[model samples]
Target: MEDSHSSTVYKCHLLNGEHVYLKIPYSNVKFHRELEAYELLKGRVSIPELLDYWSGDEECPGAFLLSELKGQSLTREVSPTVAYHVGVIHASMHAIQPPSSKRLNGIQNEFSNWSAFIEKQFYSFAEDVKEVLEEGLFNQSVEKFKKMNQQLPSPDGPSFVHMDFRPANIIIDGNKVSGIIDFESVRFGSTEVDFTKLYRDFLSADTTLYQAYKEGYNSIRPLIDLDVVLSFYRFIDAFNSIGWCKRRGIEKNTVFLEENTVRLKEFLR
Candidate 1:
């Protein structure tokens, strides 16, 4: 049976009629990363408790895991209050300072110097935009971003960042968030990266949500040069999305490419 989102989710009945979520991964590597992240963060944060994971077979290298989630996704129901709470949750996650040894591979190195880190990781993306996208408007926007990148502010500090912080990854029940899922993209970077997704994708130019998120973040840790950090990641994210869509052979992402190009132009200005 298909869920509302058309994802093939299985229900495993546990003791007392409780059910565990068994999500089948699309590929072996994705399964491995998802399971690895679940193991890394099971007891460390408010995530669905992971029970067990197993690979399907040699011919079919995909895998599945049993997890317990107490709430539904917040993407279906979003409001100003939910947005505020999402910000609070995001801030709390970033405040969790894991040991250096515990950090992810690329993230650990980046924590030492975020400016160089972003430049190193995203410079290739800029090149991809130049090569793959032949549109004059997009090319102009990319060039403008390259020049504007010199003026962006540097990171003030390193924090635990949920690189894919968005409504689909957050689970809510009643008025409280029950779980935050999908940590495969977790990294040690500026929290502003996470905030940018919330602000741009979720709030739709609503400054109130941005303010609420900022208040929540400031309550936990102060932000310095946040606008610059947000702008940098926003550009990188735009580039990454276009690259990803191309790699996945998704033609529909042309719209996203155009949208992000315009957004990058505005941010550069």
Candidate 2:
């Protein structure tokens, strides 16, 4: 299948004519993390059934996995009502409290506490484009981001966050949600962080879409100081996305980056 992101994904038919989704991770760590999260949440959520996972090293350089699912992505066609159900699904996932033993230090701490991991694994990406990054527009954007991140509120409780929740990650069939794919970014974080992607990226800021989502979400659980959490995530997301685009040599996404930055600044004010 055609993929928009770095990861390559394909649809293959099995001997029984069953459809399976295959994802080949670009990095070893990401591939392992995807498998870890899949194993952890397999029976708990409406994820595709995993058939197998294989890890390959220098000779192969990555990992690949097979999973079965039965619908197109919700990003293909979304409406206010669809946004509402998406909210419901996200809320449900957050309700599943992970065992204390399973929780790792969050992404925020990963950069600090996991510095060794960062050095061994992630630093290459940054080092590769350090020259481009230093002379780029992103240098100023990063400085502004530090200021915006300071306005975020502390998390109230730890919850299972999809970390990449968005219409593109959801699969739909007719009027119903068939499945959710891509658990690679799964983490234990403020549940509100997950909702930020939906509210800011997927829903188009349409009040009707926002209300529908809120209605479905409130039907399940009460959100605590939700506006504060949304604001926090909005700022952080814009900040992180800008850095990500910079590292990838992406300039067109600057428009989206600037738009969210403005929205976050306004909300904070």
Worst 10 residues of 2 by lDDT: 106-115
**Residue 262 of model 1, lDDT score:** 69
lDDT of 2 by residue, 61-170 (tens): 35555666566777634576776776677677777665657654322223222224323332343443344333444445445544645565655345667777877788
Tell me the TM-score of each prediction against the true structure: 0.76, 0.74
Q: Which consecutive 10 residues in model 1 have the weakest lDDT in total?
A: 1-10
List where candidate 1 sits over 4 angstroms from the true fold. Answer: 1-19, 23-36, 55-64, 75-80, 100-108, 252-258, 261-269
For model 2, how big is the CA root-mean-square deviation?
A: 5.2
Candidate models: Cα lDDT each: 0.64, 0.61
Tens digits of lDDT, candidate 1, 65-126:
65666777766345557667776777777776646565443334256676676677666666
Give me the candidate number with maximum TM-score.
1
